[model samples]
Target chain A: MVRQKVLLIKVGELKDLFRKLFVVILFLTAFLFIMLSRFDSVAIEALNKVVIKVTGPVMQVVELPARVIHHVWTYFYDISHIYAENQLLRDENKQMMILQNKVRTLEVENQLLSRLLNYVPPAEASFMSAQVVAESGDKFTHLLLIYVGNEAVKKGQIVMGDESVIGRIDTVSPPYAKVILITDINSKIPVVVERTRVRGILSGNNKDLPQLIFMRSTTDVQEGDIVVTSGVGGMFPAGLPIGFIGSINGNRVEVEPMADLSRVEYVRIVDYGLAPDAELSVDFVESEQNAR
Target chain B: MRDNWRENLKLFAVHRIPLIATLMMVFLFFMPINSVQINYFRPVVGIICVYYWSLTRGYIFGFFSAFLVGLIIDIYSSLPVGVNVMIMMLLVWTTDWLRKYFSMSSFGVNWLAFAIICTAFLLLKWAFLSLYFHHLLPLAGSGLGLLSTVMFYPLIAYINALIARKFLPQERIDE
Candidate 1:
């Protein structure tokens, strides 16, 4: 009885010690990760990929029901507007044919002009489409997890919605990738006002509209000006549409992205295989008419 | 031996449901359907689960289990590895520490305590993120989220009670 009592007391004491030790170890590990992340450790990045690869399928399964519900809801909503939308489409199609003719003539004229000037066009980026699989649940940051990985995709590839640049892939793993939206606080894109040709940095503040920053005071930036990628960093291709100037607050200019980020169902990941400092050259240009 | 095994399996079934349910809620939060605005307003479902189980069923989630769960949440949320780990540990410890008072208090009183704790949790999370990122994160969305989470407590509590009544033994409630 005495030996049993002694053993029980020892076990209780050990449990208490273990609990205290566990707390210290757990907190230390967490803090270590926080510090290591500041340095952008490769191991941490690898771990992130592993976690995503394992969890991506689980997330897809969980999201299936909600996606179905959304589709059904959208189906009903679209059916209600189908007749009106079809009429609008018909009218738009007539206008589009006329616009297509104008574009064709412009394209030929531009090709001749570029040939005369010996101007080099940029390489057109090819894209692999991926469906958005999951999302970060945090209220502070804007991130999307998509169903494509580093195996076929790389970080810094431009993510697009139709014709507009929406975000870039931040990280990739085997079966999943994370896209940091232009509205994330961490996002910064080199952009230019298409009309004025003035360059500025597109910065996100976790708002729906990202701000254009670092423009020279003398730069002629106007409200309602279209913004496109400047291709300064070579991470994104030149002339990819970004957004339009929304409102100017003193030096601050907010840009409203043309892509409806909230409604984006799938994104195109594009690779522009230019060197980081490579400038646009004639060798990069491909003419569809010449190819034909 | 068969009777003993059957009893053990029954006990596991009753005890495991809350943990499983909490995990399912985490998965639901990870789904892509939420808009960016709505994503910011997600209720801390893990806390609600922990609070409910600890209060009614006398199941005090141990520190390690809480840590593991937090890690899963961190992985799911794409947070810095340890952020949710620390937050979840704090939640479990606080809930465990206050379990005694909760048992003695009226439902309204217990809920008021939850309100206070949830508010503190949100504040702690905000402060941690600000410190981690070295920037002032906007608080308006999280404030709205807190309101919704608080508002959701009763419904979640009712659901928890139903589960407890249906699956759990009377001894757990009495204790």
Candidate 2:
């Protein structure tokens, strides 16, 4: 009986030792993967692509219930507010008619002035709309996966919500593209205050408000100033609405993104056709590496 | 022979319940909820599953299952590939070490232990992420995530326990 007990204890010890060793091996393997991903090798990219391609469909299927819930909720919400919305629309339409007449007069005046000055028009941007299929859904990162069906959606295309810029295409695999939101820590865009034309780099800190940095110390900026893309980097077109300055501490200024990023169901992917396909990717990779 | 084969298949399916359930939780974690209010309170469901299964049935829900769960999260999330893998592995290892003390304890005691471990897990994840980004990340979001996970622990634990009681063999569960 004592012999059997001793053998049992020995077997238990061996099992414990094996468990410890396995944990260590897993830890090491995880570390190796982190390093491999940091370097962003071809193998890792290919693996990521394959994983995304396989899981994209699965995510869509899983998202069906949530989609149904959202649609039903929206239907009820719209019904509850329909009367108020109709009244508000009627009031807005009256104002819009007056504004439209003024705009027509301004357009004719601007055309005559432009012909006199020989002014050149900016290149028109092309856009495609896609439904947002998935989101990162974690606090650690902000990203959206949009289903781009058979379209030639390229990297560095700007993704816009109903009224303003939301994010940009970070990676594109056919039938799906990953959008890095303006609120993500990794996002940086060159923007100018509309009233002041004070150019600065808007940096996301994974918060609701992204901070504007790199402006002149003497430059004037105030709360509630509208901010727009400066087209400095050629990635985003100039005069595209981003947000308004939400707050301005002595030097720290934060802009609240105009789009309700959390509620975005569809996005317009705009291509300005400025930079070559490889240039933006190269720049983004280099910047990431340099940040590391 | 066919009867024997069917019995073996049943056993195999029963044994895989914990891992399969945990993978489903991983998928549920990424389900797209459009509400800002709900999105802000999203819990770390994968960690809860790993902790519960490892504490209750480590022999069945082993390291490889934990590793696979983490890999799936890594693939689905925008974060770097191995961060979740490392987090899940550590969770399993930690829970395995403490299983003897808490395995037989009351649900409240188990929950208290998980709350502490989940905090540490979030800190470790934040540190790894901050290190990866070469900067310190804000901790408020993680704090909210922790709160949500801890608040929802009882529901998740109950669901897992039900699965364990229903599908897992009585001897394995008793162990």
Model 2 interface DockQ: 0.67
In angstroms, the error of model 2 at A129 is 2.2
Question: What overall lDDT, based on C-alpha atoms, would model 2 receive against the true structure?
Answer: 0.84
lDDT of 1 by residue, A162-241 (tens): 87999987777767888888988877888889998997778887778898876765248778889999877666777889
| lDDT by residue (tens digit), candidate 1, B1-175 | 9998887777877677776666666677667654656665677676776777756654534566566667767665556677777887788778778887777788899889989998998799888878877888778777877877887888888887787688767675211
Each candidate: how many clashes? 2, 0
For model 2, the TM-score of its B chain against the native B chain is 0.93
Worst 10 contiguous positions by lDDT, candidate 2 chain A:
A276-285
Q: How large is the i-RMS for each model, in angstroms?
A: 2.1, 1.6
How displaced is residue A169 in candidate 1, in Å?
A: 0.7
Worst 10 residues of 1 chain B by lDDT: B57-66
Model 2 lDDT per residue over A1-292, tens place: 9999999999999988997898789889888889988885555667677877877787677667767887899999999999999999999999999999999999999999999999997777888999988778568888888899989898778899998999888777778888889998878887889998888777889988898877765248878889998877668888999999998878889999999888888899987776724355346435644654
Error of 2 at A44 (Å): 3.5
- Top candidate on TM-score is 2
Error of 1 at A38 (Å): 1.9
